[model samples]
Every structure is written in C-alpha cells, then in structure tokens.
Target: MTENEPALDSLTALDSKAPPRRAAVIINPAKSGGPALQGAIFRLCETQGWAEPLWLETTVEDPGTGQARQALEAGVDVVIAAGGDGTVRCVAEVLAGTGTPMGLVPLGTGNLLARNLGVDITDPVSACYDAFNGSDQAIDVVKARLNHSDKEQVFLVMAGLGYDAAIMADTVDVLKDRMGWLAYVEAGIRKLPGKPVKAQISVDGGEPVRRRIRSVMIGNCGRIMGGVEIFPDARIDDGVLDLLVLAPRGRLGWLGVVAGIFGRNKNETESVEYFQGKSAEITLEHEQEFQLDGDHLGTGTHLAVTVEPDSLKIRMSI
Candidate 1:
C-alpha cells in the first residue's frame, strides 16, 4: 500500500457502533486565538455529539503535560492537543504507549509537527473534523534523558545541544512572535561566532566518535518550519532517529551548511554529518545548553536519547 493509503483494518477496529461522545481538549490559552479558539473548540465538540467535552487550560508554569495526563485519566475517547510543537510534544509524551489517540490543533509560532503530519494549521473547525474522523497512525517519539548530575528528564520531537539550543535560549519572545520563522535565521547569525565544543558521541552500538561540533540535532521526524527538510529521510513512525552534526570550519562553510540544509542536500555539505540510529549517547566536554522541542532546558553534560518506535497514536487526515 502507498503511504497515503488508509489502513482498512485499523478503521474497522475503531468502535463504529457508537460515535465517540466524550472528548477532552487540552488547550494553551496563552497561545494565539485564545478564548475565541477555545469557544470554537467547544462548539466543534458539541457538534460532534461530545456533550461532555472537558476543557483544560495549560498554565504558563506547568505547560500541557499535566493537563494531558488529567485528560487521559478522565477516560476521554480522544485527547486534542491545541497549541504549538512544545504542547504537542508534552501531550504525546503522556499519551505514548497508552493506546490513546492524539489530535492536533496547531496554535503556535511554528507548527512544525502539524505541517509534517499534513495537518491543516488554519481552519480549526476543519482540523477538528479531521481529528474526529481521521484514522489512527502510529508515530515514533524521541525520548531523551538529560543527566545533570542528579536530575533527569525526557524529551520528544527534536532535541538540540550547543549552537541550536543557544539560539533558542537567546531568541527573544517578542521577536519570535513578531518575526515568526525568520527569528531563527536572525538568532542563527548571531550565534555563528561561538566556538564549537568538543564532545564524544556514541551511535547505537558503535564505538564512541569524538569531534568538535557547533550543534547536534536528534530528530524523530524530518523538516523544520517553512518546509525545510532538515533530515529528509527521517520518518515519524520509523523505529530510528536522525542525528545531524554540524562542524563548520569558517563563515563560508557555515553558509554552505545552511544552503545544503535548505536545498535538502544535508549529506553533500562537508561541514555537516548525518546518521541514523536507534539510540545515541553524548558526553560533552562541559555543560552545554539544550532545547527540547524549542523549549530551553538549561545546561547538561551527559545526554542519552533513544527512539520509542510506534509509541504514540495520532489521528491523521487520510
């Protein structure tokens, strides 16, 4: 079957005897469209016969993970994550391996995952319709354990250490909102002068590979915002992660790397290295800043990341 072919067996497995009448929407009110969007969601759910639609708002401090956990605990048939990539990642982390399907309602600056899944970022009503009628698809999730002496935490989607993370940490919130995806380019230019850090990385069962790198990105799915395929071959449902290493030698080399990334010729760039692996371990020379799904997570010395194959069920437009 083709990639777009709907799995008849999976659709038949869905309980069609009765339409799903209960749903929980975990929304980030701070995101764009706020109350108006939430109201629309309520209307959409009601239209779908979801009389008891539970609405949960994400707090500025707690994010959506806690809310998603609550939604799952409430036994809702579908859990809709209404926010950006960070919110989606948090909800996916909780819903993974639980046989609970996740629905996306993109409402952030960069809806990377939504674009990857062929989701309609605009038209919340249409998006919700797809959520209600779409078949379930199993997708891969990247689980990262950031070891900072005593503390550890898991990450989903994309994880970055060094240059990319530094750019994320430094990017001003106002600029991000105003400039959208262009903010990353401005931040990247500002971060180009920093010295590369030496690190030891082990891919799958391979021997430790040591190199001086400007940045390292581990991606479960290909592409960033604006359809830029960072890891062109990366698949969300595949049981592997794409590891991208950048070690530009000079200003011209860095531009070349950027060109390659945008041109979908990552392997052609001399300053960049790409690999696919089930797991990876990175031991930095010193503590380095990192970001998980665009959210900065301070500094860490040791990072261990693995791909959880088909761990999350997502409602996709067939």
Candidate 2:
C-alpha cells in the first residue's frame, strides 16, 4: 500500500464500528409541553451523536405497555418513559426482566418513580440528557394480582388497598391540576371515616394473621407524594417488599398513625405497623378500593403482591 493511501486495516476497523444507539421515547401527548419536550429530545439526540429517537405517543386506550413492547421489538438501546407515574409503571411492566434499560423524563404532577430514583423533576432537558447518557441500576419491581385474577400487573412505587385507594379514587382532577399532591388531602379527609375491613394477611406464605385494617400499602420504595417516607426502611433494590398496615381505632387513632409515620419511633404504635417480606397475600372482608402506583384500579377483595428482585434496569445520572 502507498504511504499516502488510507490503511486497509484502518478502513476495515472504521467500517466494523458499531452503529449509533437509538432510544424509543414513549410519551403522553396529553401532558403540557409534550411537543416541546419531544423537540428537545430530538435535538439532544442529534447533538449527542445518537440515532434519532423513535417517538411513541400514548393514547387513552393504551398508556405505555404496548409502546414499550414495540420499542423492545425494534431493538432500541433504551426505552424512555416521558410521562408521569402511570406511564412509568406501564413501561416498566413491559421492560422488567427484559434486559433493556428504561429511562425517565418526568412530565407529570407526581413523578413517583423518578423522585425515588433521584431524577430531577423540574428540568426535562437534563432528564432527557440523562436518559440518552446515563448509568444503569437494577431495581426491584413488584407484581400484584387482584381478586385471584390470572393477569398480574406490575408496580414500581406502591400498591394500595382500602382507605389509601379510596383517597386515590376520590381525588379530584381539577384540584390535582391546581394543587398537585395536596389534592389528595381533600380525598384523605373524606375517606377517613370509612369502616375498617377485616384482612387476612399472609407474608411469604406463612399462616395468615387477621386484623382490622383501614389500608394496606405495599411499597417497593420509601417515599410517596409530598416527600412522605411511609416505609422509612424501604429500598427499591433491596429484593424485599415493605408492607404498611394502617388500623386506626377512633377519631384520635389517626393522630397516632400520623405520629408513627413521622415520629422517630415508627414501630411503637399499633395504628401503623410495618412488615418486610418477599411476598404478601391480603384478603379483605369486602371489596375495597384498590390502587397501584397512585392510579386507582377500582375495588377488589384480594391482592397478592410479590417482589421481583433487580428485575428492572433504570438509567439515570445518580
């Protein structure tokens, strides 16, 4: 080969280099500034020398589960959920155990999973940047089956039964738009007077323990809306599910539950009890309100939850 000519070996090496990675952004077009966010992501991907992202818009009929499966089929490097908690949960349900990492760009009122992952909620551009270039961390995703149903739904944050779910059901959308997480306060107050349902809770297939409970919150992570650490010891990647049972006796019983949640001595009160296990089965006396990741799923009499350890790979800077 001539000295001035390009080396054949170097040319082959250049041609053999891998193609640019691409991302599928499953976004909720209903969110404010959705088009603007998509534009921002398009520009950022171009600047970062990556392939153009495949934009998927979520519809009323299908949130993200279908879109996520589509992304996986396309062999995208990353699947980014660019909406709220519901969208994140739907994408996560599909991506869990699939080996493809999921990214987050919080564009909703309560970015529960993003908040738990320490992703910045205020800045969408920074979030998109991290979605394009970030490290992956394996986290646990909990699967819940209601009313002995054959189908099991996955939740990344928390699943609620009874009063908590009632709060989710009663929360007003207009108030939520104006007040954000505080909108739940109105619902909570309205739900406080409900009767406790007798629950038979079995953890890890152990013998069932009966109790009068107002709510059963199974958490995969620690915090919730308004930065409340309901399960203080909970960890997303811990490979365990944290369960909180609320059983208030009287009008004054809620005070103790509040104290137990916020006070240093959390385990001191019976009104609020915490349990850790790999799986839990709860059978309520009646059909009570049920919710998954803050989205109410109507009423159910039974809920079985199991923790899938390190099943989801979440990509973020932190």
Model 1 alpha-carbon drift over 4 Å, by segment: 1-20, 148-156, 259-265
lDDT by residue (186-257, candidate 1, tens digit) is 887788797778899899969988888888999988878667788888888889899998888777778767
Which residue pairs in model 1 clash with each other? none
RMSD of each: 8.2, 1.8
- What's the lDDT for candidate 2? 0.92
lDDT tens digits, residue span 1-318, model 2 = 887999999999999999999999999998888878878889999999989999999998999999999999999999999988999999999999999999999988889899988998999889989987899999999999999999999999999999999999899999988999999987888878978989999999999989899999999998999999988788999999999999988878899899888998996897988888999999989899999998889898999999999999998997
- TM for every model, in the order presented, reads 0.89, 0.96
Q: For each candidate in the order shown, give its overall lDDT on alpha carbons.
A: 0.82, 0.92
How many residue pairs clash in model 2?
Answer: 0
Count steric clashes of candidate 1.
0
